[model samples]
Structures are given as C-alpha cells and as structure tokens.
Target chain A: MDKEYQIQGTRMKFWMPKEVDHHKAAALRDQLDRLIEMHQIRELILDFSETEFMDSSGIGVIIGRTKTIGFYGGKVEAVNLSAQVKKICCASGLHRLINIREVAENDG
Target chain B: MTDKKTNHMHLYFDARSVNEGFARMVVSAFLTEMNPTLEELSDVKTAVSEAVTNAIVHGYSTEAQQVELICDRNEDELTVTVSDRGVGIADIPAAMQPFYTTKPEQERTGMGFAFMEAFMDEVRVESVPGEGTRVTMKKCIGRENGR
Candidate 1:
C-alpha cells in the first residue's frame, strides 16, 4: 500500500491523487488528521503535482487541515496547482488563506 | 444552444464517493468531440463534480442511493444536470449562500454551490424536500472559435 503522505522535519507533504472529490475526501481527511495528531507538524504542504482534478471536496480537505493545524500556528501551502485547480481555488477564495507556490521543473 | 449539432447522454450510478471521478471522466470524455479548450473542459468538470458531490453528501447524506447525470450538448454549449433522490434542501436560497454548510463539522465549506455558479455559464437548482434535488449547469465550450 502506498502511503498518501510523507513527513519531513516540520513540514508534511501530501501527494494528492489525480481526482479529488467527495468520495476520496473522507479518507484523505482521516489520513491527514491522524498524521497531524502524531507529529508536531507546523507546515502542511499540499503537493498538487500529481493532482489534475480538484473540486469543492478538495477545498474542504484543505480548509479542514488548515483549521486543524491553525491551532498550533501551522500554515498550509499549496504547490504545483494546475490551471484548473488554480481557477477553482481563486474562485473559492482559498488564495487568501494559503500560500500558493509555483513549482519549477527541477524542483521535485 | 448553439446551431451546429446536439448530443445527449444520461448516466446513473451509486452515490459512492468513488464514482465522483467516474462522473468527471465520463463528462470530459463526452465533451471531447466538441474540442473544448482546457479551461472550458475544466470548468464543466468542476461544476459537474460539485453538483454530484452535493447529491452524494447532502442529498443522500453519504448513504446508499443513486445519483443521475444528464448531459446535453448543442453547438458549443454543454448542459449537465446532476440529480439525486434523497433528502432535499429545505431552503435552497440559504443553501446557495456562501459559506453556509449544514455539515460544517465534516469540513464542508458550504462552497459547493458557489463553485458550480463560478465554473458554469448558468446554474439552476430545484429541489423538493423528502424527494430529490436537481442541479442544472450549462457552459459554452470551444473557445477557440470565439464562443
């Protein structure tokens, strides 16, 4: 079984699936919740390099994680968002809360 | 409604979350023949996913039920209707309000309908309590031809 996330120091990077919707949101949320509980995570990096499709459910997951980590003054950063995901995020006002970063070709 | 041609399709599937990807794939595939721009395609996919998720989460409350997707394409416009025969919304206006979610504890941002409105050219919602809810959204694709 492939782990859905990886923890590195104070930053936990989550590799989301290609499709993010209501069906997969719950499981993803649970996994993230458990990880947050076990680790002293201060930065949640949502790596969207592998994600092609994201809907409101994806937004829900990000918001939920943001609130959860906000308790510890943790911040969430979204990286490598495709144009489609970026449009949705802009419309949902997510850019106001999270730092949206661009990924370079060599930046794995 | 464009003047070139018209195509229609209907799909019925379980309200499981797994099918959300299925719904997006099917709709995108169906629209491929129209040669929609990437943005146009993504807009439709996002709108469809939001409507379908609402039906699965709010309409059926994640229980075992059925969600139906009906799509109509005419010229450069694609119309999609996602419906579910589950608990209907009592106050649709309230439901459409930004940041008004019934399941906030579940991390629902109450932005489902908002996303639909933002992505699609037109969005219309209708529901009857204890019966079902239907979300109809339309978008003009093929932006290359200046649609």
Candidate 2:
C-alpha cells in the first residue's frame, strides 16, 4: 500500500499480502524496483511470513529482484518460507544464488 | 463439507508477500493436507515458490497485479496452478533454457524452470503473448513417481 520502502544500509524488508493477484503485480514490482533504486541495497531480506499464495508472476519477481541484487554485487535472502513457498523456491534452485531460512519464525 | 469439496483451495495475492520468506509460508500451507515428509514437502514448496515468483517479477513485473493460485488435492496427489495476466513470455523455449533471460541488467540466474523441473513431478506451461501465462505443476506424496 505504501509507495516508499525504508531500507537500512543494504537490507530491506517488504510484505506480500493475500489480495495480490494478476492485477497487482505491476504495482508491486514498481514498489520493489523503487525500493531497490532508492536503497541500492546489497542484501535484500524478503519477509514472506504473511503471504498466502504465489503464481508464475511471483516467480518473475524473485528472478527480477535477484537480478537487481546481483547487479549491485549483492544477493537476496529468502526468510520464513512456508512449505508451499519453499517447494517452489527449492525447486527453482534459488538457494544457489540466495540464502533462505526460517529464522524469523524460530525467534517468534 | 467433507465429501468432494474438501480438497480444494483458491488463493489470491500480490507480489508483496511472494518474497523468499512468504514463499515459504505458501508452500508450507500447501503441504499441510498431504502430511508429507519434511524433505518431500520442502521440495514441493520450493518449486511452487519458484513459479509464483516468476509470475510476480517477470510476468507482471511485480507491479501490483493480482496472482491466482489454485490448489487441488486428490489422495496423495497435489496439483497447483499458478496463473497471471501480465506481460506474457515472448519466447517459450528460450525462456525455458537454463541460463537465458531478457533481464540481463537484473542478474537473473535464468534457471527458474530448471529448478521447477527438478522438484515437481510434472510441470506444464501455457502462455499467450500479450495475454498472460499459466503454469501447472503436480506431485504425489509417497509415490516417488517422477521428479
């Protein structure tokens, strides 16, 4: 809902909601790209604790963001992946480029 | 409610939560019905996340479009259909290649499909230029049919 995202050094956080469908991908990417441009972040830590679902379009976001971080010589880290989310991430071999973990939930 | 409609769920969301973390949650929930082993579930979740992310960033450019996720379960078999009406892929075969991507400036590994194939039993993709793309993936628990 917010256009601008806050970033500390290179780490940035964002949340994906349950209403995002085909129509919301553009705006989401715009926000993410804006955040990326503004922060020039090195390592992006994505917080996906609340998301309910994702599709092929969602995959594009990861690929696009990973590319963004890779351009900055940084990397993306996936955090708190649920089984559904992890299935796709693991299948895509995303771990080879980015690190994914369940640390946030462990702390909670 | 337990007759024939208990094994179906429809989810819709934006790219905001498709982050690597949220992707995890989505996958976890998807596997709950199957009661799969951790390793088996993990593999499925990762594959699903991969496809969803593609729809967000590449499919819709992760702007603000809606993502539709349909899950159907039959016994030990689960089928996930992730669809998006965003910028469709211009090249199907090229996109499926191991390391080919249009967003070179973005530093994409270009292996989204590769990973999907490695994790899920079957992956099917259908796209219409200027329309959208839909990816269908299926896997069965405890069968070890095909990966």
Best by lDDT: 1
Question: What are the TM-scores, per candidate, against the unseen true structure?
Answer: 0.92, 0.57
lDDT of 1 by residue, B52-97 (tens): 8888888886567899999999877889999999999899999999
By summed lDDT, the worst window of 10 consecutive residues in model 1 chain B runs over B138-147
Candidate 1 per-residue C-alpha lDDT over A1-108 given as tens digits, one digit per residue, 9 for 90 to 100: 854687878778888888888878888898888888888788888888888898888899998889888988989989889999998889999999899989622345
lDDT of 1 at B120: 86
Which DockQ values do the candidates obtain, in the order shown? 0.83, 0.15
Give the CA lDDT, 0 to 100, for residue B108 in model 1: 87
i-RMSD of all predictions: 0.8, 7.1
Determine which window of 10 residues in candidate 2 chain B has minimal summed lDDT.
B15-24
Model 1 DockQ, alpha carbons vs. true complex: 0.83
